[model samples]
Target chain A: MALNVLICDDSLLARNQLKKSLPADFDATIVTASNGLEALTVLQTQDIGLVFLDLTMPELDGVGVLEAIKAQALDCLVIVVSADIQPQMQQRVMELGALAFIQKPASADKLAAVLHKYGLI
Target chain B: MTALHFTEEQRDCLQELVNVAMGQASDKLARYLATMVHLQVPAIKLVDTQQLPQHFAQRYQQQSVSLISMGFFGDQGLRGEAIMLYQLANVDVLARLLEYSDDDSSEAEMLTDISSVLTTTFLNGLAEQLDNSFSYAAPRILSSRDQHFADKLAATAQQWQLALQVDIRYQLTDYSFHCDMILLIPGEAVLRLRQMLDQILASF
Candidate 1:
C-alpha cells in the first residue's frame, strides 16, 4: 500500500523542487496545491497521509491552514516548509503541532528523514 | 556652518556596515531560495538630492525600480534611514533565484512578501549585534519622483542638508539577477552609528 502525500505552496517552483527531492522509491501519490485554501479542498476529497506546506502564502497562511486541519480533526501529519527561519519562527511552528519545521528548499535527505520518522516513506 | 556631512569615505564605512548586515541577510535569502546567495562588494558614493533624477535616469535606464521605505528610531530620535530599494525583476529572475518555476503569480504580487522576510531577519540580527532596540513598521512601496522623493526625505532631515547614503547590490546565483539596498542615515545618526560600531569593536 502506498502512502498519499500533499505538497501545498503558492510557488510552482516549490512544487517542482519538492518533486525532485522526494524519495523516488517511496510508493506514494504526491498531490500539489497552490495555497492553504486549495490544500483544504484537496483534503476534503483525498486520503492524504502527510503535508509539506509553505508559511507565507496568500488566501491563508500556513498557520491558518494548520488550524483548519486541526478544527476538522484531519488525521494527517503536517510539516511547515518556509524561508522564515528565525529562532522564534521555528518555535511558533512547533507550538502549532507541526511534526517538523523544514526550512524552504529542504534537501532530499531532510525530506526523507521527516517522512521516515513518521513511517510515511 | 551647517552640520558636517558624510563624504565618499564615510559612505564607504557605512557600506562596510551594510555588507555585514547583508551577508547575514543572504543566509536567510538562501534558505528561502533554497540556494546559496552572495552579495558583491558595493561601489559607494555620495550624491546630492538634486542629482537623484539624473542619476536614476542615467544609471538605471532600462530597469524599473521598486522602493520599500521604513521609519527607524532608537538611541536617536525618529529617523527614516532604512530602505530596501531594488529593481523589480521578472518572474523568471525571481524563479531561478528562488529555485522556483514560472507558475506562481502570487509570489510576485508584493515585494514585502519575498523581501520583507529577509529585511526582518537582517534587522533582527543587526539589533542583536548592536545591542540596541531596532523595530520598524512593515515597509511600503514608493515612487522615484524628484520633488516627492526629496520632500519626503527632506522632512526626515529637517535640520540637516545632507545625509549619509549607503548602497549595496545583491547578486542571485543559479540565475543572473541583482537588487539594490540603500540605507539613508541622518547626520546625527551617522555619528551615533560610528560610535556604536566602535563600541562593538572594543568589546571584541
Candidate 2:
C-alpha cells in the first residue's frame, strides 16, 4: 500500500528540494500545498497519510495547520522540516502531536530514519 | 539591470532563502539570550534606493532608532549592505538582559555584537545554499546620540540605483525584544542574485 504524502511549503524551491530528497523506496503518492490553508483543504478531501510541513508561511503558518489537524481529529502523521530549529519550537510541535521534526534542507538519511522509526515506509 | 525584477518563482525562492537564513540567525540569538526566538515570514521587495529613507520612515514609523550597517560581498558578484534597526525604547531591555552596564561604549559593543550574529550568520546561510561564501566588513553603528534613523540611512542610500530589500523580524516575547533586519542588494548584485536563484531552481 502506498502512503499519500503532502508536502506543504510556500517556496517552490523548497518543495522541489524535498520532493527530490524522498527516498527511492518510499512508496507514497505525493501532493503539495503552497501554504497552510491549501494543506488543510487537501487533508479534508484526500486520504493523506503523512505531511512534510514548513513553519513560516503567508496565510496561516505550520503551527496553525497542526492546531487544525488536532481540532478536526484528522488522522495523519506530521514531520516538520523547517529552518526554524530552535529547541523551543521543536518541543512545541511535538506537544502539538507531530510525530517528528526535521530541520530544513533535510538529508535523505534523516528523513529515512524518521520514516523507518515510525514504520511508515 | 533589466529593471531589477524578480519573477514570481524567483521572489518565492528569495523569500524562502531569507526565511531559512533568518531562522539560523534568530536561533543563535535565542540561545545566546537564553530565550525562545519568534520569527515572522520575511518580506522581499525591489525599491528605488533613493527612496530608502522614506521607506524606512514610513514602514517602521519610529522617531528615533539605533542602526547598524554591515557590508557583505561574495565571490559570485553578490554584494550588499545589511541594516539592523533597533527601536530606542527596546535596546535598554536587551542591554539589561545581556548584563551590559549602562554606558555609551557598552551600548555600542552590545549593539555591534548583536548585529554580527544577525548579519553574518544570515548572509552565510544564504551563501551556503548558493554554493558561495561571503566576506563582511565590520558592522558599524550608523546612528549616534543626536542622529535619527532616516538621516543616518540617507548617507549610504544614494549610492545604489535600486535595491532588493529583505525585511526580517525576530521577536523575543519573553524579553520584549523586536528587531527589524533589512538587507539591501543593489543594482548589478540584484541581477547576479536572480541568476543564482534561477540556477538553483533549474538544478531540480
Candidate 3:
C-alpha cells in the first residue's frame, strides 16, 4: 500500500518548500493542512502514515497536535520540521512523540537520511 | 492602499523568512532569561505615514513604552531601520531577572542590552538567509522614558508616505517582559527587498 503523508504548517511557503524537498524515492501520497486543527481533521478522516509538523502556528500549535496525537493514540509517525530550534523545544516535541526533528529550510539529503534511518523510504 | 506593490508570493516568502528570523531571536531571548518566550506570528504590511498611529493604538492602546532604533545598511543599497519597543509596565520583574539596580541609567542600560540582543539576532538571521551582507549603526534610544513612541514616530516621519512594516512581538512565559520589534523598509529599499524576495523565490 502507498502510505499517505501529511505536511502541516501555517505558512504556504514553508509547506511548498518542504513538499519540494521530499526525497525522490519516497513513495507516500502527499496530503497537506495549513494548521494543527486542520491537520487533526485530516488525520481523523484519513489513513495517514507519516506527518511533517511545524511549530508556532495559529489555532493549535505543533506541540498541541503532538499531545493530541499521543492522547488519541493516533497511528502515524510524526517528524517535526520547524523554525523553533531551541534545544528544549526539540526535547519537548520528541518527548511528546515525534520520530525526529528537522530544522527549517530542510535539505533533501537530511530528509532522505532520516527516512532511511527509520526505513520509511 | 495605493498599490502596496507586494505580490502574494513575495509576502508569503517574507513572512516565512521572518518566522525563521524571529524564531532565532526568541531563542536567544529565551536562553538569556532562562524562560520560554512566546512569539506572535510575524505581521507584515505596507502602510502610509498617517496610519502609523492607528497601528500603534490597535496594538498598544496608550501604554507607556520605551523605544530604541538601529539603522542597517544592506549590500544591495538597501537601507532600513529596526525599532524595538519595550513595554514599561513590567520593568521591575525584568530588572530582578537581570539583577540591575533601580536607577534610570541602569534601567536604560538594561533596555539597550536586551534590545541589542533582539535586533542584531533577528536582522542578521534575515540577512544571512537572503544571502546579503549588512552593517549596523549603534543602537539609539528614541524614547526611553515617559514619551509615547507613536507620537514621536509620527513627528519624525511626516516626510514619508509608504513603509513596509514587519511587526514582531515577544513575551516571556510568565508575562514578566514584553516587546514589539518593528522592521521598516522604506522608499527604494522596498524595491530592493522585492527584488531580493523574487530572487529567493527563483532559487526554490
lDDT of 2 by residue, B73-180 (tens): 898688889888888778788889999988989988998999998889999998988888999999999995568778778877777667667777788959777878
Q: Model 3 over residues B94-143: C-alpha lDDT tens digits?
A: 89888999999998888888888888998988998889877899988888
- Ranking of candidates on lDDT, top first: 2, 3, 1
Interface RMSD of 1: 14.6
**Higher-lDDT candidate among 1 and 2?**
2
Question: Per-model C-alpha lDDT, please?
Answer: 0.63, 0.87, 0.84
Best by DockQ: 2
Please state the Cα-based DockQ of model 1 relative to the true two-chain complex.
Answer: 0.01
Q: In model 1, where do residues sit more than 4 Å from their true spots?
A: A1-121, B1-15, B43-47, B89-92, B95-108, B144-163, B201-204
Q: Residue A92, candidate 3: how far off, in angstroms?
A: 1.4
Pick out the ten consecutive residues of candidate 1 chain A with the lowest summed lDDT.
A83-92
lDDT, model 3: 0.84
- First chain TM-score, candidate 2: 0.97
State the lDDT of candidate 1 residue by residue for A22-118, as single tens digits.
8887887889998889999999889998898877566887878888888899888888877555455567678877899886556799889987887
In candidate 3, which residue ranges exceed 4 Å CA deviation?
A: B159-161
- Per-residue error for B52 in candidate 3, Å, reads 1.5
Q: Over 4 Å off in model 2, which ranges?
A: none
Put down candidate 1 lDDT per residue, B28-103, tens digits, no spaces.
Answer: 6767766655445445554454444455546566666655565556655424455565555553577555554454
